[model samples]
Target: MLTEELLTLAAAAGAAVATAAGTDAWEGLRTRLGGWLGRGDARGGEGALAELDAGAAELLADGTPTRAELERYGAAWRDRVITTLERLDGPEREEAAAELHRLVEREPAAREVRGGDQHVQGGIRVHAEQGSLAAALINGGVSFSPPPPPVRPEG
Candidate 1:
């Protein structure tokens, strides 16, 4: 039987795989996940890659998938991971769990921002909505005044 921690790790791996699909992190996650599932068998690794590709394709087919759809895929992958861990022997299972933990640790969190020139020296939050754009380059602090009310046509 798998420990609760391992089971939680499996679930996190599943969610990470699902979220990483179609993103910059997908390739690395896909390759590592294929290796994990393959367990040193070349053909098995190839097959796993094929399966991962198919899942990613399906998830991205709509271009903009709803949150529910993402969750569905996440759950499916989670079940797959749990099943894989369940099939392993004690030592193998432990090693696989450790590997999976590493994979999860390396995965970028959702909405993570990265850029070469961008530097954040302190906490910053920018929110844009309703066809507006917001940006900040804060070294110390900043403030904003509300926009004037929308114009009304003359009577």
Candidate 2:
């Protein structure tokens, strides 16, 4: 098992990767991250790309990922990251961590708007909170909450 800090880092990386899907940054991210996760192995990189694509496809089909679904993906990738890191020596692990950090830092902020914010891929559109978008595609699922109270001008 990874230490608490490492697990957190893995989860963050997973979330960042998830957020980058279906965006302009996705292709570059997909290739670079796949290469990293694959440890320079072409087959491994391809596998990673497939996984990323499948997740994006799922989101497109469902329209939004449910909270549970996003968590599932996050957990899945987190475990993968942890496993990959575990196999590395100290220096390699540090380098991987640095790379992951860079990836996370580069992710765009999430948008809460309704229209243009949707991520379109292969002509399929999906709308959800930015970072949380990965899990927005819960089939037949809908979430509702009261809108925030309007702000009043200072008296």
Candidate 3:
């Protein structure tokens, strides 16, 4: 059974893969991911590479993908990563998770969200990125909480 941490790592890796696709990072990421999934098997590595390339092609088929498309691809890759992790043994699984975590950290999109103020209400936060608009509708009573004051370093 995969641990919660490993599962989260796999999900992040999937998102990273989706984000890296069609970008300059795609080549390096694809090669690393293929090797990670391959686990010393050349045929497995080639298969993984092919699958990743196909996914990238599909994602970029329409030039710029929509948010929905990115989510869809991310979910598919997440499932694939989860399945891969589930099939691995203990040490290998840990190693793979670590590698995936590193990849995700290195991915620009996976690392940060650059945009406007994020508002959290009822434990839900809405984020808007550059050249994008995001809106959330909440039924029932809505409360607006002021953001916490920034901490100042004491001299």
Candidate 4:
């Protein structure tokens, strides 16, 4: 089970590649994602992905990551991400699509961001909002309604 942060990072990477297009960073990142797509199995990069996952998780746990490495790592995650989202259907799919759009808009590859250089032109993107705990609860398939209050006195 992929973490929400990972999924979000993936989306952001997609956005970066999308806006930048032909830039080296975009191409490199796209290449990595393409590798995943080409392989059709993120499970293949188990070791490398695990190392990255652990590193990212540690940074997140420390809550003190504000650097370029994070961005690159994030960009590297879009491959498995967009792939997974592709498997869904209906409302969930729509939600993922909307999230991807927003991500692309916010992190448009054309605009000069802190990390990737301004060079590329266009690349594939699937901006997606990282799911939150609330979203998870909603999607948990558990029905919940306010419990009936104590019987009111007959008026």
The models' CA-based lDDT, in order, is 0.79, 0.68, 0.79, 0.49
Superposed by TM-score, candidate 3 places the C-alpha of residue 121 at a distance from the truth, in angstroms, of: 13
User: Which ranges of candidate 4 are over 4 A from the true structure?
Assistant: 1-75, 108-155
The positional error of residue 124 in candidate 4, measured at the CA in angstroms, is: 18
Taking the candidates one at a time, how many backbone clashes does each contain?
0, 7, 0, 12
Distance from true position, residue 6, model 2, in Å? 2.2
TM agreement with the true structure for every prediction: 0.69, 0.61, 0.70, 0.28
Per-residue lDDT tens digits for candidate 3, residues 1-155, read 78877766666777778888888899998998898888789999999999999998989998999989998887788788889989989898878877777767777665442122333434776799997998986655676779789999999
TM-score of 2: 0.61
Candidate 1: minimum summed lDDT over ten consecutive residues — where? 110-119
In model 3, which runs have C-alpha deviations exceeding 4 angstroms? 112-155
Model 2 poorest ten-residue lDDT run: 109-118
lDDT of the structure predicted as candidate 4: 0.49
lDDT by residue (98-124, candidate 1, tens digit) is 888787778754112212233445545
What tens-digit string does per-residue lDDT give for candidate 2 at 11-47? 7767755666567877877777788788878899889
Query: For model 3, which pairs clash?
Result: none
Give model 3's TM-score versus the native structure: 0.70
